[model samples]
Target: MEINMFFLVLLILIPTFVLIIQNKRPKSNLPPTPPSLPIIGHLHLLKEPLHKTLHNMSHNFGPVMLLRFGVRKVVVLTSPSAVEECFTKTNDVVVANRPQLMQAKHLNYNYTTMGAAPYGTLWHALRRVAATELLSATRLDTTTNLREHEVKLMCRQIYNDSSHKVNFKSWFRDLTNNITTMAIIGKRYYGDEINMGDLKEAVEFREMMEEFFIVMHTETLGDFIPVIRWIGFDGVEKKMIDLI
Candidate 1:
């Protein structure tokens, strides 16, 4: 009975001590932040339609606010003047790079791909190449007919349906995938690419695309709470690595 009481007291004391340590603020001339809970910081304050939640915070905590999501510190700006000032030539290097995420390691060829690469010489070169050759205005103009054909196919599919109810998101994604595939490579997964004999392959490709977006968009706890990664509790990150 005595041992049980001691254990209960220890459990209660440990959490209180941790919370007290986590809530300690440092001295800095920084923007104001909302009162955050220990460990999770301000994560609980977030809600759907994230933009509206952020705007509401701006009304309460001024235009520029410093927020913490688990261990990650974020600086949010609602005012146009603050945004413009931060993005000026002097602060270009500070805010130019994208945040490193689990998806970047898998889908982005271990962060070397143009979409996820850090803002540096490689990224600059990739943007220049894309602008000049791959995604140039001339290239897009030439593919206008191909894009139209994909849209027509989507329209025809919808028209053939007896009831208008359908997964509009899937149809839109298929249309987008068709355009991107046909533009970069002269091949497609839908429409002209598949016949009755290859229907299985087409179905497989569609399922794969769906799964890709599902995994990519899903949240990773390690992203916000860095310790989850160091302690090897990153199952989501592992799944992403295995996927690619």
Candidate 2:
């Protein structure tokens, strides 16, 4: 059949094209790469507690190695000297830009927020504002009493509820939020004394934050597996947009 002939020709041409392109690339002074498999490239070698794996690789290979995880290329450095060099004044400025991540695109206001943003005029301006107006040493010092007050309230709740199971993580997160809100706007959204309107807002805020972190931590398949992604597997994309 014609379809069989077409399939035969396609399979034969694809590898030939790949080989031709590989032969055309100029040689580079790249660092040694570990044995990697096609399409997954070193991903199969990764294990739980990723820092340990990187450490073992660096220990055997060298302090620095270029690695590819799925489709992303990463430079792993274990040497203190190499780290110092990378973050030195000149190199620091050169590499100050943040990488554009798929999750950040939705969660970080299109990478416009303070931490996710690329280094440029906008980032510099935001840094200046934070340094002068929000995170200055004087500003933090002025809020010491407020932070202590919030901590005492948290401790009081724990002390009163010592008989039952306690969600320490929730309590600590609320305590931190209360301190931040109190410092910025002189308001606390959590606690038994808050009105129903404020309580609703607090619940919504907590839900939003929980979903944000959950989605942010989970790796999207589209990010790693291009063929599946290109074929319109967009479940992660839809979930993120719906959550947003």
Candidate 3:
């Protein structure tokens, strides 16, 4: 009975001692930050349109400001001089690896693509292949006729609709899409599938791509709390998979 009571007392005392020790530790050694609350950290202090908030904070904290988003520490570089230093002086060290994302993991052909690949032999090989096969002068020359034909078609469409007030935005988007499709797949897919819409399946796919980008660019707690990623708090991984 005594041993049981002692064990329970030790369990409670050990955690309390650790907490006291942690509290006594000097916070001056840590990086500067805006005052924040517990659990949520600086999250509540952030204003809407986070980029703007960061920009505002930079005026007080200098060009390089440290921000805590949830449990993560992020360094924001706001000045062009600082950005130039990162790109020119510390280019290799600064741009070492791409951040792993759910979409890249599940849908980027296992990260075999150049966009998602790390800076290594495989990435170099993919870059070389893309440069030679897709961006080469020979390839561009071969596709020149297709590009011209598509542009001519676009001109005709604009001429036919000259009298009407048309949406130049949609028209330009369709033209761009048509040109890309003809160049890449050797076919135009605009306005083909009825179920997809009067616009082609490719246009629908473009809309989906836009939505995926919007979500990825938005801030989320998982990005800050690494452990929360294990629980899949935002269903980010699943949404990424569905988008792909």
Candidate 4:
């Protein structure tokens, strides 16, 4: 009888203690957020064209608002003044680090590249190296001849196309592709080789570029939900692994 009574008293006391502690805990002093559901939070509230949805929400919720995406806390900032404050006044605090993107996690030399790296000594060193070695005045001067040659070829192609009523979009893409190829690999594969058809290499290159852009633009739920990242639900992690 005594044991049973003690057990009942313990259960009651535990819950009372828990409630007191929870009540004592300080609430976040952050800005208000829209109503959020449990577990998934505001995941289902998002609409097509995410930027438009965010803009509409900002209109109702004010320029600065907090949001819970999955288990992640997000701060949404709108209005030019708020943006100026973030970028100008609090630049170091606001933009101190880059998020770990799926591609960066796998393909970027363990996120060591300047574009993907967290802002610090390593990223600063990499940026300095790229600026000095790849983007120096001498490097640009060396590539000027290549650029001029590609531009002249583009002009010739345009002249030829004037009589044929060709597609301007295709012509422009081809011209840009030629310039990029020359800049990167020091070879212009514009027209054709002995085996390849006219501009077939450029066409293949453009197709590859389109595929890369599509992959990069895709949204992955794992980005918001830390738990789902381990499961690789969206295959973004797998894709990055394969690319690497």
Tens digits of per-residue lDDT for model 2 on 1-244? 9978976886577556645765699989887789765556688888989999899998778998988766677788899999999999879987688767778888888988888889988898888998998889998899999999999989998989889999999899889888877887787877654667678877886678778888988777577656445555667767788888
Worst 10 residues of 2 by lDDT: 225-234
Q: What ranking emerges by TM-score with the best candidate at the front?
A: 2, 1, 4, 3
Candidate 1 C-alpha error for residue 13, in Å: 12
Q: Give each model's whole-structure lDDT.
A: 0.81, 0.80, 0.71, 0.73
Per-residue alpha-carbon lDDT of model 3 for 62-166, expressed as tens digits?
Answer: 887677665556668888987788777558656667866556666577777898998899998999999999999998999888888877887788888899897
> Against the correct fold, how does model 1 do in TM-score?
0.76
> Could you arrange the candidates by lDDT from highest to lowest?
1, 2, 4, 3
**Local distance difference test, candidate 1:** 0.81
Question: Using lDDT as the measure, which candidate wins?
Answer: 1
TM-score result, candidate 3: 0.72
| lDDT tens digits by residue: candidate 1, 1-244 | 9978976886577558757775595667878999887667799999989999999999999999999888788999999999999889998789988888878878888788788999999999989998988788998889999989889888888777638687778789778888887787665676544567667877887778777888888878788876576666758877776676
Q: lDDT per residue, candidate 4, 146-220, as tens digits?
A: 778777777777777688777767767766777777788655555432135436766766566666666666667
Off by over 4 Å in 3: 1-31, 37-40, 191-220, 226-229
- The residue pairs found clashing in candidate 2 are none
Better of 3 and 4 by lDDT: 4
Model 4 Cα displacement at 235 (Å)? 2.4
| TM-scores of all predicted structures | 0.76, 0.79, 0.72, 0.75
